[model samples]
Target: MGRTLVQKLWDAHTVADLGDDATLLYMDRVFLHERTGSVSLKGLESAGRKVRNPEQVFCTMDHIVDTLPGRGDDTIMPSGKDFITTTRAAANAAGITLFDIGDDRQGIVHVVSAEQGITLPGLTQVCPDSHTCTLGALGALAWGIGSTEGEHALATKTLAVNKPKSMRISFDGELGFGVTAKDMILHLIGAYTAAGGVGHAIEFAGSAIRSLPQENRFTVCNMAVEFAAFTGLIPPDDTTIEYVHGRPYAPTGKTWDAAVDYWRTLQADDDATYDKDISIDCADIVPTVTWGNSPGHTVQIDGAVPDPSNAPDANTQTSWARALEYMDLKPGMPIEGVPIDAAFIGSCTNSRIADLREVVKVVKGRRVAEGVKAIVVPGSSQVKLAAEAEGIDKALVEAGFEWRESGCSMCFYAGGESFGDQERVISSTNRNFENRQGPRTRTHLASPTSVAASALAGKIADVRKLG
Candidate 1:
């Protein structure tokens, strides 16, 4: 039997077999953010240990940092400055590269990692954020870890990890108009349940995945954790190699040639077999949105809110009932015309330049609807700069959206900036659990274009209807 891509990457990084399905795997890159990084760095200091390879580790101010213009150490989140200052001091003391506030490189860890070429094919990476799985778009084996595990990887450059069963999800057919990578993922979770991929390392494959741009691949893999997968990855291909070729931290000259040769071979063998396999018909996917708090509680843009009484199980029925009550939604109500108070178009999940461009396409020449507060935040400063060069930012601003600095803004309620209480929001960010955006703020997750359309309509408008 041939080995899957996950098997190949796992075998390549095995430092030692620790028995009982656990392996001491070498981590090629370890990323950190102010939110959880301070704890790991402080713990390492208390233990009197040093980073095994500081050059391979990187830190940034993102989690609690304010994304408002002219922002500095001070943040809207209570004590947010302490997290920033302490992380800066600790990162400096440890000798790892720090993308401090105001630095052009400052951004979300996952976004910066990809943009800087810090993650590449076949490498193993980890961060203290769940979205670290976003890096797997480059065909890397990456996942999230706790602060304690972060310290271990920093000190030894290796971590003891239990091997997860391999699963392959093949997306067949082409995506229809107005549907996006975000919708594809949302549709998957909705169809299979969020726990569908539990305990498995999922490898996304097939025609639809291959057809996605590199950034779209990131959007798809970013939510693998939300799918309850241990991690997710896409096999690197020519598009990936092209994206990494000239990146600052990527290989150079002869090294680049050698790296490309290896990356081309990163795909699974023709006969490779996985522990589980699932095939999805992309033709059936549409512009999807979450009607309930859980991402799994999703429906097509034109579909009606499902009745909790029809839920598959008693537990599911109870949860759905609570979600409906919290959201103030009625069973069988059409989701298409539901009113929204805000629209957010940024997060590690969908804040890349490609995503912003999509937003611009929908919002240009159109003003936001009255009573709707809309904002567009790029994933990185680089992304922001690029969008400005192309006039994407100006277009958005002209359309009545606030053009803001880059960071994980309004993606979660961290006692900082957030939507008003009980506000209904259509957001491009991943995750829409109750109170995710603010106390009593009900979030509806959708794609960038969907968000822009909703912002203009002041409701959960379908992007497909824009035509």
Candidate 2:
């Protein structure tokens, strides 16, 4: 029987199909970040338990790593260094691999895992962070869980997960230049609305997905939560295999060939079934930016904010009004000339070397807007090393963008530092959730290139013009 990509991957890693619509899934890898790991470890301690599979566990500090100079080590992390320190100590005591602050391997858990080749096709993985779905780009079955659930997995090496209904988002047309996975996913969120995929596992398939670079695919899956999907995935392909090759945790020599062969076998069968499906014309999507708090409230820069009259339904009109009021935006106004106070070009979703290089192409020989603050934060120390080797960092710094140490930075502003209150920022991070970047601040999310262009123009300008 033909199978859908989700089913294929799901079945491949099912340790046991426990009765009751849920499965005792086998998790080959587990990730923990500072914010959630601390509580999970505390739970394990309360239960007088030890990690069941220390080898499969990995911990990284990213969620609050300050992206500014002299603050990269989180000396003043709002939770006090104690929270992050406890997680590091717990992981170390449990024999779990820890990417502690300042560790070369340290960065966003998802970025470090992929950079180190820990996320492989056909693998079942989970993390305490929702963006764990980013690993799905490597064809892994990955998703997020709560602190208590993470502790349960850490203690037992298994998760009781319901098999989610599947939705296939197929695409066929070629994406236009400067149109990236960030744009595609933003468009998807807009088309489906934030709650459209509730309770479903989304499989992003078809030619468009296969053609995207591995980093871009990561960007696509990283924001699955915005659509309320349990997870988002892309099947492994040659690019996936090649990108994994030679990394620290990747298969080597004879084993490498065998891994690829087995990975290929895990592809969906020709007749695979899905609970629901939608096909998108890739050519129809344009470079996109978020106009409101939710990712679903996005429009092309050239497009105007939604006028209440264009509302598709009563519910749509209400949503539009709410978003407009919350964001302090005027409906029917063109977005291109919206002034920005700051620009950010890094996040777990778009801070890979590929993203940096793409922005470098536009930023070289150009300078950021004089009064607009901007920074380039790599997702991990390894990403920083890779970008520096490519001289992307130098280009970015030369273009008036500060080059900072690897950390989540302004992507999370719970720490003391943040953009101005009520200031507008063009960012490359995943969520535009209210107060996500800072209290009372406005955020417009876009691709790395778009952010760079905006930083230079001091407004929400398109990257195409920078080129």
Candidate 3:
């Protein structure tokens, strides 16, 4: 019996077996953002503890930072400036790399980590943010941690973790037109339920996954946490190698060659076995959108809202009822043509340059529907610059979209900025939980192209139906 890819990664990073299913694993990279990172860093300083390896730690201004143009330390979120300034002081005192508000590298932690080559195949990475799992797309073992865990990793460079059972989800067949990685994930969570992957480390595989561009792979793994999985990964291949080859922090020269050789061997063996296995036919997936508060409450773009009575269980039925009431929607209502007040495209999940290009394809010559407010914030300053160089920003702005600076803007309501109360919004950000975008804001999660189409229609429009 061969071991799964997760087993290989765990074994390689194991510093010691701490017994009772816990292992002390050495963390190669630890990333932090202002929100929770300030707590961890401040705690470490108060305890008179020093970072074990300052060079391996990285911090950035992201969560709660204002994404408006010409912004600085001042933020609309109450005391958001304090979080930013405190994190900056701590990072500087700790001698760790910091990507400040104006730095080109400044972006969401997950995006910055991969773009800079700070995350690598076979490395164990941790961040004090749920979306940290986004970096797992590179074949790394990455997951979220609480601030306490962040402090521990920063001080000891290791964490005692319970190994999760391994699961393999193979997506076969080819994705249809207008379908995307975002839809693929939404469809999975919709079909399997949100808690399906609990206690498991999922490996996304099969022909469809292999065929995805590296950026698309990131989109898939980005939502594994949303699926309730401990983490998710895709085995590194030629596409992975090509993407990481010239990254700033990636190995160079002979070191690059050695790293590639090791990465090539990181795949699971042919006979490898997993604790659980599932197979999905890409043909069954469509451009999906969430209709209720939870991501699992999803339907096809043209599907009707399901009645609570049809829910699989009593708890689900109750959940659906609550979601429908909060959303001001009714059972049997068609999901499409549901009017929306705003559209947002920016988050750790779907704010990369590739995501922007897709949005541009749909908005190039079309104008946003009258009375619909739309905005597109790049994931990072680098992505912003790249989009500007190619006029992607201009196209969006010309189409009635507000082109804004980089950062996790309007992804969640942090009391700083958000959509209007009771406003219905189609967004590219992950998680559509209640009050996620604002007080009484109803969010619909979709792919960037789908979001563009919705913005144009001023409703929940299907990308496939767009002319």
- Clash numbers, per candidate: 0, 3, 0
Candidate 3: clashing pairs of residues = none
Candidate 2: where is the Cα deviation over 4 Å?
A: 70-73
C-alpha lDDT (0 to 100) for residue 255 of candidate 2:
92
- In candidate 2, position 359 carries an lDDT of 88
Which lDDT tens digits does candidate 1 get at residues 74-147?
88777888898899999999999999888999888899999999999999999988999899999999999999
State each model's CA lDDT, in order.
0.93, 0.86, 0.93
**Candidate 3 local lDDT, 1-467, one digit each (tens):** 88888999999999999999999999999999999988999999999999999999999888888988889888888788999999999999999999998899998888889999999988999999998888889999999999999999999999999999999999999999999999999999999888889999999999999999998899999999999999999999998999898999999999999999999999998999999999999999999999999889899998999999998899999999999999999999999999999999989889999999999999989999999999998888888999999999999999999998788889996429998899999999988999889889999999999999999999999999875
| Model 2, residue pairs in steric clash | 2-271, 2-272, 3-272
Measured over all alpha carbons after superposition, the RMSD of each candidate to the real structure, in angstroms, is: 0.8, 1.5, 0.8
Cα-based lDDT at residue 65, candidate 2: 60
TM-score of each: 0.99, 0.97, 0.99
Segments in model 1 whose C-alpha atoms lie over 4 Å from true places:
none
